[model samples]
Target: MMRAFFNRIFGAKEPEPLPIAFGSIPGMLDEREAAARAMLKEQTRDPEQNIRNGIAQLQLIVNAIAGSEHDPEIHPKLKSIAKNTLPQYIRAMNTAMAKELPNDSEEFYPAAVECVKNCLNSIRGPGRYLQIVFPDEMKASRKGIDTIGREINAITVALGAYRKEMAALSDARSRYAAIISCSEDLAKAAEKNQRSRLRIDEMTGRLKEIGQEMAAMPSDPGMAQFTEMKSSLHQLTVQLEEKTRTYAALSMTASHVLRKAEKIATKQKHNDEIAFLKHAMALLSDHELPSCTELNTALAAACPVVERMIGADEIVLKNKEERAVFAETGRFCIDMVQICSDLHAQEDTCRIAHEALDAHPIHQKTGSLEREKVQLEAMLKKERQSQTELTEWQQKTQERIPVLRDELKNKMEGIIGRTVQYSDVFPESA
Candidate 1:
């Protein structure tokens, strides 16, 4: 008695579940599903057939209710109510029975349940009113609905475990497929990471070699001349900068006075004077040094405008620099002309020196190696970035594989009714 009471309390102690492997899950799941389907068909066959026969009995009862005549002695009110409600109950029952139940277990289960519920509702809802008038028909209809309900209940009880097993089997299939796909992706990512590492090493080593070669490059025959030209270019650049600065200061001051002359000329409608003043100011304000001849010509025309403005008191020189520059406009023009000429000559010399240096093997080789070094550094950075992303993916994938394996193991244990030991090797975690 105690043993039976304990057994009733806990049901039966389940046996240990069977073991499976990560790789064999698909084939095993397929075999289990096929067996379950065959079992479902066998178990559901009699119940489904009974449900159909019960439905036929229910439909016949519904038709009998439709065609049966009411008693002439019955109360007028009850007869009128039955006349109205009888057709409604018949249509409801017929509509419920109209559904053609499918043969598949998955589809047949719900469809059978729906028919049972609908038939029961029709009997409970409208048949209650007609019970007195059509007593035999209503009683038969209720019995038919009960018969169908019982068969549907039997199907439900029989498939409860099958549904749970199918669900577990389906879950195992998904987990196993995901594990396989994850393994493939992890492998491809690892291969790409390896290639990236190799390429990065190659570029890194090449960069080192380039650095060594640049440092140990032998002296060339024209190196002496190249050094001399480089020094000459630097000196010319310095001299030209000084000359340009001096010329800018003087020209800006003179330009201020010239602008006043231009405004006055505009008011007086002296187009020629305005043009001369604007042309000279443009040359001084230009980013590049104007030709010496261009400066001489522009100043020759424009200086007279500033001098005339000073003579006519149309402009006032505020600063000492302005006064000095405008006070001796002829000397200023001469100095500007010499400065621009020297700048042009120096720039030409610098240009020729730059060309010679660029054409030399040492400079050309050095520039090429430096450019190559920069390119290799960029490629190495990109490779490192790719490697980092791949490493992160591999880590996440490696972590996920074990989790999926554990879940699949649990699901397989549930489905197969045993403690499932996965017999497959897994990739190591990062």
Candidate 2:
């Protein structure tokens, strides 16, 4: 009955004792909390030491905000506020450090005591008394104003320099404009001279064309009239050549003269102007006729030479025509200064006849030889056409050959396999 009663009270198998790991008892946790509280009490015991350490920590916080060093102990909630308020705190600290301690005044002693009290109060709470304890916060508040003043000063200096630079640039631009104007004037003068040169070139080309035409005509009685025409053309050519040469020379001289005048006009400095004027006077007084007058005189002198050359050319042309006419007709009817001037004149007529024959187009087919040539060309064309067809057929045959070979190889393999199987079955019978 006693055993049953014990089992009823303690449970039928006495429950296994609850397992407990070492060092997990409630007393151990209570002892740890007590130790932590004692350490905190010890740290806060000396208020003066706490103040010093707090001040040092605050200095570190200020340094971190100022970008001088980092503070690991600063709370996250306070970090942003501390960063913004640190400059003011540092300024206050600096004011306190720089304060002149009053030696003879009782009022100053109370004020100093009150200042310490304010600092202690600030440390205990939200730190609003920090501003009252230190006066340098006013200086720090004016820092941005000081920066603005410095910026304004820098902007004024920069504006003055820029204005001076603008003046210099304007002067440079004026000088550049003068240079461009001078270049444009020079270009215009060059264009004028180039036009004159082109005119001269055209006249030269016309003279050469006339000369060629004169050389190409056949000499006949009708050619005697052309001989007079040729004489006129030769005189025209000589006159043109002389005039063109004169104009070209005059143009060159004029260009030089204009350039010298331009140089004199452009020289504005005193020494440069005096030198240019002296040079101009020397050029003007140089004892030669001006280029235009010299060219005119030269052209006038060439006129008589041109006429004499034309007369000589006319006489030669007339004599050549008369000789040619006589050679062709076997009679000399026209009156000429010389009739038999050249013995080869007859050979020249024969050569001209041969050239005419070579240049003439064929009118009638010549004999059976033409028919044979036509037949031969037709036969050759047919042969070439047959060759082209044969080449195409050969290309097609070559393409088909590879496919046929592949088919033959497959048929041979099947036949060999079937024959081998039949031979295996019939070996004993054979």
Candidate 3:
């Protein structure tokens, strides 16, 4: 039961038996014939059918040695016999059977007989001595026999490749004939493209002539009239722009005076505000009731009056209205200019006072907040240090529990003299 449980946990073990190798002569011949017959069946079905029946028999003899079923130590010797030694004998046999010996080589037939005999010595079967004749051939000339076999194999390969190439050439000729049959259609398309090209050239020439005529034609009378009117409109636009600038400057000056009077009234204390308003009323009275009517009229009037008031700067040609405002009584314009200057100067003083007020509050609050932030950061650093120490202590405690459990399991196993289940000692770890 313990052995079975061990097997269940670690998986079963079994040894593999070796495969058998062929050594009996009858068994070798039987395998050779079977392989040859199988190869012949497939060769007959192939379209090219180039594998000769004689070659298939030779291939079977080669397989008897080169095949993977032999022992490793004997395999190399068997491979040399099948691939090199026997091929020489097979070539001589085939050549003699075909009766293709050279006229000058009388000893070639004797050599063929001797090579066959040597090969038969290795392959003993039912009918071997009768198939090949043992002749009185030179033992020293075996190398020449081997050379002849290699040359024969090369020639056979070349002949097969040549035949395949010939078949491919025949297929290519058929495709060429198919292409020749479509030549008339291709010629017709070429002729159509040529006609389209000629038409396009003719249209292109006509379009060039039309473009020349258009460039030569005179300008229209209506367009000339439009050019003249545009020039006159541009002059009027310049005069209107000048009048607009002059009017804007006059309005800006008047508004500046009113703005100054309003700003002077902005006092920090209630008493200061009352006192400034009283002073403004007294100044308005000093300008007198007559000057007030003129100021009010100029302020409320149209663009032309404002233009006339500004045009008085050039005294060479002034209208009666410009003279009454700028020359006879220039107080309103002078007073407006003075007030604009005073207000511009006061803006700088107000900016400085406002900056001082804004800085006071930020400086007071930031110092207090900065001190509190420093204390909190220091506290956070101390807490993180404590947390790190606690985490390391907990890890060390957890590590020892595993080692203690392992020690207990070892003691129990020694006492019982058998394997201990890990689940019996620590169910959670299991």
Q: In order, what lDDT does every prediction score?
A: 0.85, 0.39, 0.40
Models sorted by lDDT, best on top: 1, 3, 2
TM-score of candidate 1 to 2 decimals: 0.85
Question: Candidate 2, residues 1-430: lDDT per residue as tens digits?
Answer: 9999998898787344333222232333344445544543443334323333433444444344345432456555556665566566556544432344343222333434444444333333333433332224323323322443343344344444444444444443343344334445445545654554565455455545545544544443455644455455556556545544443443333334334433434553445434443443333244432343333333233223323333455222234433342232212211110121121243344455444433433211122334544554565456555545545654554444444333423332332222111111211101
Assess candidate 2 and give its TM-score to the true structure: 0.21
Give TM per candidate. Answer: 0.85, 0.21, 0.23
Which ranges in model 1 have alpha carbons more than 4 Å from their true place? 1-22, 218-222, 256-278, 304-329, 423-430
Best-matching candidate per TM-score = 1
Which residue runs of candidate 3 sit more than 4 Å off their true CA positions?
Answer: 1-55, 62-228, 251-430
Best lDDT goes to which candidate? 1
Q: Candidate 3, after superposition: displacement of residue 59 in Å?
A: 3.7
Instruction: Tell me the tens digit of each residue's lDDT in model 3 across 1-430.
Output: 9999999999877544222221222243345445544553343232112212333344443444233232345446454444454445545444434443232212332443444454444334211221222111222123333443554444345445444443434443333333333343334444554554555455455545545544433254344544444454555555545544453454444343333333433432335433433343333333222233344334333223333434543122234433343342246445543443444344444455444433543333444445655654565455455545545644554455555445534433342334454432222211
**Candidate 1 least-lDDT 10 residues:** 421-430
Better of 1 and 3 by lDDT: 1
Point out where model 2 deviates above 4 Å.
1-80, 83-141, 144-151, 157-161, 164-168, 171-178, 181-192, 195-199, 202-430
Between the candidate structures 2 and 3, which one is better when assessed by TM-score? Answer: 3
